[model samples]
Target chain A: MKVPNILKKTVPVAVGLVVLGYLTLYFVINQTPQWIPENLTRLARQADLLENPEAKRCFECHKEIYAAWKKSRHAIAWVSETYIEDSENRSKEKCLPCHIPRQVKNGEKPQPRLDHRDDGIYCVPCHVIDGKMHGPYDLFSPPHPTQKNLQYRESKFCGSCHEKTFEEWKIAGVEDTCQSCHMARTESRLVQKPVLSWLHSKKQVGDHSFPHGEITQEDLAVTGEISGKEFIVTLLNQKIPHRVPTADNGDPRLYLYVRFLDDSGQEVDRFKEILAPQQDTALLYGKEARFQYPLTAPVRKVEISLQYKPAWSKDKSEWRQLSYPVTGDSG
Target chain B: MRTSLINSLLFTLMLFLIPLQLQAKDMVVKAPPESLGKYYPPESKEPKWIQQMHKMSGNLGGVFVNLREKDWDNLDKNADQFVESYKEASEMVPEWEEYFDLKAAKEFAAAAKTHDGEKIGKAVGAVGKTCGKCHADNSISVWTRFHWPSFHKIKITDPIEEKELDFGKYMGLLSGTFKGVTVNFKEGQYDRSQKALRAFKSRFMELKSTCSKCHTTDDVKLFYVGENVAQAFDGLQKELTAEKPNPGNFWKNVGILGKQGCKNCHLTHRSYAMIQERWEEK
Candidate 1:
């Protein structure tokens, strides 16, 4: 173990100079007039003082996720007229808890937000909690502290609010969760910030849109046959895991509309059967609902269509319709 | 010296057996096989599994009754039927074959013919022990899985607003209105109290309409959601208006609603409905 004398003296001198230079730069940068570019990401200017940032603040970095969330039913949970009226203008304490909910934890219903009543079920309540941002990832972000929480990837996390649907899902006895269906995953960088996001590689991120995975004619299958003086049409809810037109507090509807035309192709009779959950009238998961309408007139053709109105929707035009062509003629 | 040698041998035997007992005890309880669903509904046209179970129990009961009456001819028939059903059942579900003890059945038959009470009892007990072992592990899982109909799937119509609500929300409204009657009356808001009572009455009565959703049989609908509950609600309305109303009258109606309407129905329905959601065939 022979020591090199020249190395020791030069090493100390270089280290001293480096320290002195760093001190000078730190003093100069903090004290002097600095012209930072206006286009610099918010990562550079962390001057926003609100302890709890709005969902819009997240838009600066998470533009796509922010946009999707803004368009979600959760965004209008607080401001929706239906919610307002149902809650008796927020006078009902029981109804207000879920609308402007605080942080969600696994299996526990969230408490009402104390500070941000207008935000609804927004970003801060879901992702931000306990002075740090939480997600289903273990990654670095200099702007804020991060903690990995696996509950974000589970159905029980959403069970905090969508309790009834969650229970229905559990009874379905399927492994696929609320998140698995609704917040489907895609590969992309979670952040849109310039240099900060570049440090991270592309990874699986959930779609925050919370899409219901729109039901269509593909979901509800209609088949029929005319038996003498009777027309029997069966609507099978083939693909959906839950009852069609389902809701917790709201009355969503499914209309099985039947139109019959005479031998001359003039409309003869029309029949409408409305179905809803908890009433046993709704189309069940993987089950068939049979409707038999009598052919009173000299029959010709049969037209069958399934229409759905979500609980939140008000206008009839907003109701979604799925129609099947009436090919055969009774005449 | 002979006694000491025997004691040591027994100690060695006990030592060897303890770990074996612990290993058996530590086996985790899992749901019965998904293959059981093969003989159940949505798979088979008839419930072959339940039919097999019923057949076995019926023959076993016949064997007991015939043995008690000392009817040798029918005893032989019932015993033969029991063994036939037992063997058939063993072949029905492969996973359950381990629980079916044919040796125990033969032993019971041999004992039953001997015409000794103690021997017959022991033999029957042994055969029953086989069933008990199988049932102890599987009966609740099977009952929870197959017997209960899903009640939570349906919605309730709120008669006051003429709107349909989810099960949980409807329950909340039901509870809220019931409490409202009490709270409004306490606050001296007689008008609000009367309004709440009216809403409560309508909601209570509207609950009857939902019974037909599940109960097609008039008897089933009549049992809980029938005339008695309807009378209870009506009695509460009249009691509230009485000149000297009993303070306990409201709670009496509450008790009737709680016992017959909520508690009894929940006992019959809720536990299985919830457990079915949790239990898995895996």
Candidate 2:
């Protein structure tokens, strides 16, 4: 069969163009942007003494992320009353670095922020490193410089401050990273301003509240029984990586109160037990806190309730009550 | 023919482009780091006191179960064993008598003699109350105990009073008060004995709250220390209430309180520094 010269010439050129197109697309999509903004260079000049204004600058483009982080524990890490009390009126020097970290060091302790101590763990510490704003994506940003940092995607970024928690997470052997559970993205939105939304692709933005105390009643499974005048209430720490009421700087507590009532529902006696930190009160991940109370009187009913108090609260006035009918032996 | 070839070439390019777009959209920098290892909590080794307490509880449970079944012989046997365990426990930590009702064991024994199911049930319940009282305070099982240090020495500082209290000093005070009770009782000075006993009880109550400071749970079991102190006071009160003071019973109670109540806890929790080191690692 005689092959036409035009067909032979066209096929090779077409295949070459296709291969080149694929290579170009791959390189552009995967490669980090080398462009550095002139304004970012000026901003980097004061990066050593970077303050809340730098974070506010980020808000100019990332409004939603800023709003979410504003309400987070990281926003008020240094200024929170609970943190103040726990640090013994801010006298604890060791605790200062994690809360107001100036730099996020890999496999090393974070350096304390000298300038914006009040801002606590704001944007610059995690995002801005060596004069560049780093994140998970290598997308285009006209106003500032950006780079893709693999550390941001890993739990190591959280580990510098959450050392014990990081260790616990490592020990837990769960495949999920800290961000997978704590910073799970809620909505897909443009990463930049509304005007530039058309320029950038819509992506899932991680929730920045970093919610740890949003545990619902459903998360804790509780059961009670009356076995020979002893009211035993068992609580299982379910759907959490760390222990129930886990914290690094604070003493969170789980209070179990059992009220014995007479036939007429009059109060007979009461028993109370507290589960706290260090004194071995914390229920380990997937463990149970079994509380046994002896009925002092001939009770018609036993009403048991569990209240979880976060480390910030002085008393258990605003307790998150678990919805469990811990009542046993009705008349 | 030219138009057809151009169409085919465009179709081939579109297929490759589609996948590239999808890949770009879904591409993350990297998957998260692999987990270091599974968290295996320290294995619990049941302490001697906890082991003995478990046996006592088992026998008590048997008594209740047998009573419910209306098995009189089994009830009697379990009741006897339960009382015997109670006695042995009392002997092991006699100071626990004040917190633990020794009378409950006697009541159980007396009811067992009658062999009446209802009476035996009531007796078993009373005995259960005594066990519950001790167990309630010392609720941390051998399993949970492994999570904690064997000894916790807490220092309480009062900001308003500007005073600092070493928990070790309070323990010393408790020991001294107990010694006073013994010394006074031996001298046959019933009034002095009673006064010292009251001081010992007051000191113990103060120390009880202090335990919660260092301990994660307020349910820390002091191994019958509180009960023992309470027993000594009760004995002193009985001596004072009687028309003729019987020094014999008071002396016997003091001896038990000193030997078993105070010393036993010290023996179990002697390695404070070592235990603290272990707890800090966790």
Candidate 3:
């Protein structure tokens, strides 16, 4: 079984090619930074380091993890609409301590300094191993090295700030938790039943990312009309407390003044109720605040106005109003 | 031809397998019903917020009986049990049910259970606190002119008594860091709203009594309902002011008196009979 001349020549060429590839790869590998840099992993592992200069350095290495954290609710917790509504000092220490845990926890200079006020939820505190905490919280350092426990992965971690919702749940006897409601098993269409009909459409195929983002007024068409005079408007309450164009307490409630202005801008008579009840016992899910308004006259334009104020404002005209037109025709 | 067919089959297989793998990973991380407690502190020691909230709820219980119950001491003795029960409901119960907090309501019940005057006062205080917190988070504020007209035009009209709008009596009670923008009214015309909101910033701090605590801040922006009605009322009032210019008539039309809009009744009105008759169901 002697090898053919061509085959022998090809084998040597292949070996030579393989050797050259190995040498190239070796040089490339040596030049690259270490995959698990000691200090980087160390900072990520320790909650204290995560709060210190080490955390910023760790981000230099673990860019992906840091990005995920920056986008999270924890990083920007203080700056959140709900938190800002709670107090005047949107950048105050009381709020920042829980939101930007690293600032207070690490005792970084500038005393109560937050590296990223915009980053809602800090990451390393939540994800680091050995970052053990007693309850939903533990103010003092744990006796052992800190670790990210599976417990933090649970809804109770979120419940620390969401006390009202947690209590309502426990009292009501609902078994479902936040994680069950928010996280997904598949990147399927988020609709409870898939709209298979969309597949037949001329549009490109669905990517099925369970589309979650702020849906502007433009995206929401007057999908269904009660009558030609009445239209259903799906407006997003991007803020957590579920009010459009939110403002401070007890001053002015949000009023969706839906006026069917004729060709001339005159208010038409119509049946109007408060869009949704303040004690919104009606457990409607999703971000959209669905409102139905009936117009008195033939409406050329349906205007949706969201005015925010408390019941006892010092002045009426001072109330803030944010009015936007729904894209599609209501009539 | 065979290779092409196999390649086609493999493409379909890859798409199917990839989605399946992604789906499996997603299931592991998917969110649970928000009602389920994600993580509980092993021992159920309520936070400062919860404790303060309980004390307030007890105050509400007392409010129903004695309109002028002071401090949270009455709450601990009378309403503590009711607040404790509701606290359990709010902290422990997991769904929205009929009278969900009713069964666990201890403040009001504690008063009934004990039949003590001071105990009843405490129970009411706790309940009031809960209402205050809920209203604080959820309601909004609106200002309406309730002052008597400087000039009277009509004769033989049903006249209402003059009430004080003096900021002095309510100096400590109503002074709060109001997170609202102040609008300049120039000879009855609305001017531009400024960038920085001029809060009655120190209002909440001055509010020592339950009435001041609950009614001082406006949650008008937070109300889930009555936007249309409120606007209509506002527009109608403006129209009436231009046309009628009579304070008594406008007050009659709005069905309210005093500076505060709805809080005028809800906070100031004590008798249950009057509250039922005057106020519409929220």
Candidate 4:
């Protein structure tokens, strides 16, 4: 068989030129000064370029993914008040490893950020690593990306900062990690990465924007009921721990108090029960939390309220209650 | 010359038959299935209950399951709905923790058949309570017998947090076994490809020790690892019983280690990487 003139003479040269062009482009993209977007790069550079340089650089190349990451807990992991307090002033090595290990690991001598402490966890700490490339999720899978092993995509990476929560869940027989609940998705964290296959598929169905927004009352349903003398209140554990008012330590709980008022609105009969441990917290999900009051001189209406904590009485005489009024089912 | 050729042929046949005869004589047959019952008990039993409390709980459970299903459509509706669901189950179920597993299996199966995420969430939430109930009763045995296997099979409908343990040494020990197996496969001391295939097959069983710890078979194929591992077991058992083994007591010792160590299967990772790796298909 005779070879075509184009195939015989120019094919190898053309292939070589194509590969050389691809390499040149890859290097140029990496080295060039990227025009980072404001949403993607939260850092202002502030005259002196000291704090979170890797993040600054990351924003330059991956403006889109950077925007998504900037909105993530990882981006703000170091800035979160909860994480700061949990870290106990960043004195503990455990906290720093999870929150901002890369800076220390890479010998980047982190100078404190202005207006906000940069002691909390950051992005590159978990994501940037050197090893045989596994997919971000698959631990046992070999031949990982050329850049790094993708083990950071596992729940264990988050386990570093969220140890207490993780352990409590284990003790509680819960098998979920932080992303399982916090991300908008019910099962996974819905982590927004540029290369995620699901996101690619999701783009086909809807917008390419990663779902990042605060959940509001519109995102939840609140209802209350009354049966006989007992006021039944139900709140869905929609997107949180079964318990309301997510407290880390102590008994993170809600108080269910019911008050019966006559026509003139005098407190006739009252009952309060703390929805403590072993109490069905799911009534908040769909079931009814029943609180009882004795049948008195003909009750006009039932008023049910949920308090985060019990009434605090500093002095013997005066007391302040942080109780919030709840809308209840009538009659 | 013909006689000499016949004798030579007969000698070669005799040489082949000698090993076959020796191997047949040396083989040790397993005892009948009746004897196996002494080692493994049937995995079905009715648990004890708290009479009056059980009746109250049974009644309350019935009421809650009904109300819970109604509002499951509007999951994001009514914060009080969630509160009440938790209240009834948490307060009433402790007295009857022992009786929750079968009840849970039945409920979860029913819930799985429903195509709604909200209803499924509520049902899953209900299942979590049952887990708490069982956990409260017999922490060790409940975990060993039911929780670990079931959890390794559960498909978590949402992402959630896990707790950390201070047991670094214990974790290291567990990680060592995984590393050892991996190394052995790499070195080809064992059939590397077969082991990888076995590991992949037993992946669900491995997962049963992980996230599926809280789920049921009907809910998700979380324990498909169990099915995978079952395939590898026959071969592994043959190797375990083989003479002159490289890791002589590795299989028996690891089985014991697994029983004692919950964290081996119930790992606490910071991300979904480990789980994704375990469950993700090639």
lDDT leader:
1
**How much is A308 displaced in model 1, in angstroms?**
2.2
lDDT of 3 by residue, B120-233 (tens): 444433444444333332221100101111111111100011122322233322322121212222123321111111112112211211122122222432231134334434
lDDT of each: 0.68, 0.61, 0.36, 0.39
Model 1: per-residue lDDT, tens digit, A228-291?
Answer: 6778888887776667766555556676677887757788876666676534356777778887
Q: How do the candidates rank by DockQ, highest first? A: 3, 2, 1, 4
lDDT of 3 at A159: 54
TM-score of every prediction relative to native: 0.46, 0.49, 0.32, 0.30
Candidate 3 stretches with Cα past 4 Å from truth are A1-54, A77-87, A90-97, A101-120, A127-148, A164-283, A286-295, A298-331, B1-282
Give a tens-digit lDDT track for model 2, residues B1-282.
Answer: 544443443343334323333434443222111220011111111234556677776776675556456577887787788778888777655445565666878897777668565565455555555555544443332223333333333443321122445556556666788777768777877667766765665455444434443332333434444455566667767885576778787677766666655666566665544444454465
Each prediction's RMSD over C-alphas, in Å, is: 23.7, 30.7, 25.8, 32.2
Cα error of candidate 3 at position A55, Å: 3.6
User: What range of 10 consecutive residues in model 1 chain B has the weakest lDDT sum?
Assistant: B12-21
Which CAPRI level is candidate 3?
A: incorrect
lDDT of 4 by residue, A31-110 (tens): 43143243433342232223334565545433555565666655665666545433333332333444555432222323
What lDDT tens digits, residue by residue, belong to model 3 across residues A1-331?
9889999889999999988876554443334324325464345344444343433544553354455445554444556554553332342233444555542222122122335545544444434433333222221121123332345435455455444444444554445554444332323321111222221112211221212233254433223334555566554432233233221122123334555666666665432223222223122223555665554345665555544333333222322223334344444
lDDT of 2 at B48: 44
Over 4 Å off, model 4: A1-53, A72-74, A79-119, A131-157, A164-229, A232-259, A266-298, A305-331, B1-282
